[model samples]
Target chain A: MSDSIPDVKKVGALLLEIGGLLMSSGASSERIRITTNRIAEAFGYSCDLLITHRALMISVNSNNSNEFFSSLKRTSPHGVNFTVVSGISKMSWKIVEENWSIELIKEEMARLKSISAYPRWLTLVLVGLAGSAFCFLFGGAGLEMAVTFTATVAGLYVRQESHKLKFNPYLNVFFGSVTASMISGLLSKFDWGTNPETAFATSVLFLIPGVPLINSFTDLMDGNIMNGVIRGFNGLMIALAIALGMLVSLMIYQM
Target chain B: MEDAVLILEKGFWFAAAAIGFAALFNVPRRVLWVVGLLGALGGITKTLLITQHQSVIVASLAGSILIGILSVIAAHGKHAPPLIFSIPAVIPMVPGAYMYRMMLGFINLTATLNSENYAQLLYDTLHNALNAVFILMALALGVSAPMLVTRKESVKNLKLKRN
Candidate 1:
């Protein structure tokens, strides 16, 4: 529609970058496809996206001229960052609404990418607090709840440390669960909590694959069977890791 | 009165836990509390059904359905996609104790050498593991039912392209 020949290749590459980022950041395939298409069309190009569990491929055609350019990107599965998804979706909407030029769109994209997350300590504390709250919800009262809080806090710290040190993700989860259950298991022996068993059981609540499970389930129902099943299997493996770690601690304590 | 207090307390913790999970995953602060409240609603709904004698499976299904619907509405209201709210809302209902118990059962069953209780422990372990798996499946299906209707259609995806 625009008289200037839109650089279909550049636009396609940008769109592909965004898609891969969203995929790696844990967006469902549906969301990634829709958002990438929306952003591309706003700039006078038609986008076709093929999203898989490990990579994203995208091609765009300049309107009328029909000159097409494609990009292929290798993407690793990363942890969920919902705020990033939320922000990027909104940004796509704004791109079309304001009729922003390609330059403006690219700038906005980088800004979204660079946005800093909350402080590490804050995230650690909040997650610890959350795990402790779930422990209470599960009937751990008073001292049991307190131990759950402390155990989860320490466990999350270990998880973060492992992540920082670049440990394998599965190993990070296993070790985190091991640490959490170990704390709860060992402390419960000394009357530190009324429901030591409950603490040991509940601290691993933080490690549940709830997000992946939810996403994969939606993916399956939406007919993206491959991505859905892959993610579901991945979630199952995480659950198994959690179970194994908990069992290891239980076996040690024999409680 | 006692029942009401217990329900309220559970709701409170569920809300707190939801907020914590959201934070841990770095959900933005602007809509952070709203997601937590949605999780609380789900927790309260399921807790009420359980106390009223519903099966845990049925209660979880009902609760996740509630969460999925609320997440859809919240997404529109907050101008965000639904996953941001839905995923965290679903976390509070996870059956952690049963999962752990199932693992414990397996460890005990395998570690013991010629025990008469092996069959019973095997059964209990299988039952707990199945229960956990089934609850997770129920949660997924419940949420999926609502989310299917909310997919961004081709038209809506390009809604702002008119300019």
Candidate 2:
């Protein structure tokens, strides 16, 4: 496989696909660069990737000839799927060691993309539990945790439903936060918990943009400042949306 | 004895939170428990440091450093990217409450510009926002420090050795 050079166009498309998958799946910029470079090296080509928050570009040149190819892909909306990231990473290594063909890489990419996420109900329940845990960690009592749990589950459900309907990402966060805070606020109005404020504060914890916030910093540290700033700004906007939602709920409760 | 029990309890909640977030991120099932264990250890480390009178930001940095190192090792053994473990594990330390408060403060500041408490609101908002920002920076820096230092050798080498 190393002796025979693959088509530059095919290699370019493959590298772009790989880069696009990694980008949308929440891989850090450094990981995307390294993984694509590794695969290109395995195929006896030199590859360059320019990754951004919403798109990826790849340029490939052959070692044995003047063949050159460059292509760009607009990535799908960002989502966190560590399973895809890990699978692609492992596949890159396998491509190097096993000398997999371009068709094989495409097949593997399809398989990895098709891998099912955890069941919706399970994710809802567990994420709700996570919110309650945050309540406890923040010094909430049992009743507060219970309230936080209910609020979080409802919030996550609403968020998921809106996402399925293709709602704007910030609007989805606003909706989820409002739902969670409203639940906790109404419960607090009824005086059902020892510390209703804690429930109110922690119920929206599930909506925190952990991945983007962390990735932004990593990207900045790696000198991918453009992507870093975009991600960081995106995270901040989502956080503001969550806060606005909570403020709306608070005003409604006061009324 | 009481302190030990408190730390254990905290660790349990942290583990549950980490596992939940990890699942939400769709980390593979086989490594969910590994993420949980790492989350517990990292949370416990932070809690212990806080108990020792360290600031929250310092404790977070220390805990995240531990997570970074451990996740690198785990990534090798499990053949997964280190972020799979580190992101979820570090979630327990994210200052969600502070972030919320800061945002709330800003909202209130805007709505109460003529009020006497405006200065207090501005101060509190800045305080909370800065705290959140620094802790987040600490976490990112701490978690990436190991990988940054080992960049020359590369995580690829680590995986290669495992094979």
Candidate 3:
């Protein structure tokens, strides 16, 4: 609607780039589809949004895709809002169009979330079992309960807490895991409940950054170079956070 | 029966917790709850499936794909974004805990200078680390399967129209 003719192709390319970034950040296919739709609305176009893990591909009927991209490159701010980059290749576009949609994608995402250690109330039962096991391992009862209590509490809070304060989700998890781990270590020193491994495991289960890391590697394997690298870096940072948290705890306890 | 009721109550709360987290990740709250429920069901069924000698990876993958499709079912009616539900629902399956355990195992093994504990520590750590890697791979595959399938369906439809 702006007097300037919106370069539909470039806009499509931009959408793809944003899509790549979002996916790399661990957004699901559905999220990317909705985002692409929103972005298209922002740019004054009704595009058929085709999103995949590695790219956002749009089919625009308004103009030649290449020319539209050039005009978009010209009109965009010299720096900040969008980093000018090579447009998505036809092959890449085809791949994306082949793999993604705005259809029922929720079940998959939910299923993924269920694999965490603190997933169900059954997790509480598992925590109880773990506590008993820890008791058997360390020859002890009271300590594990405290650990379980603390871990469950931590798990509950981790869900409610804001990710905006997070430098990275992985870092948030690392700190959280460390907090749980330290509590376990201290409780163990007091000979409380089988050394609290169960509690620590239960609480820190929410902190694992496994999915993002795997996505990064898969994207790379799928030939999404930029997407893979960015996601892989994020995964690395998360893993590092966990490793660091554990290392620091170990050093402090002289374990 | 009482135990079953208790499990359902707790399951709903946990599912609610998962949905709440999914919402924070920017999924639409309503659709996410439904997907979360199905995912919980799939997750529960997964335990049975595995026990029944069904492949864990296939069951997990199918369960996730079902979650993905069911969430998208409302896309046309709501004009809603599918990711709003899908991404959050998938968060539980990400395998972050396994990686954490592996790291813990490695740390425990390395810090233990006692030779008697060394082999046991090393073996456990390696086994966990390997499991973490494989699960991570499965999670990725599970996430991507629906996307790939949809693309194929779309292409087929397009070709059908042309013919």
Best by DockQ: 2
TM-score of 3: 0.60
Q: TM-score for all predictions?
A: 0.93, 0.96, 0.60
Predicted chain B of candidate 3, TM-score versus the true chain B: 0.70
Chain B TM-score, one value per candidate, order as shown: 0.89, 0.93, 0.70
lDDT of 3 at B48: 48
Candidate 1's C-alpha runs over 4 A off are A1-5, A190-192, B150-163
Candidate 2, position A28, lDDT: 90
Candidate 2 lDDT tens digits, A27-143: 999999999999999998999888998888888989888889988899999888998999999999899999999999999999989886688889988899899999999889998
Scanning candidate 1 chain A in windows of ten residues, the lowest lDDT window is A1-10
| Per-residue lDDT of candidate 3, residues A131-224 (tens digit) | 3332222223455645655654454344335244644555556666576566666654455554455445444444444445545654665565
Residue-level lDDT for A87 in candidate 2: 97
Ranking by DockQ: 2, 1, 3
lDDT of 1 by residue, A19-72 (tens): 887887778888888888888888888888888988888878877785888778
TM-score attained by model 1: 0.93
Which scores better on DockQ, 1 or 3? 1
In order, the candidates keep a fraction of the true contacts of 0.82, 0.77, 0.05
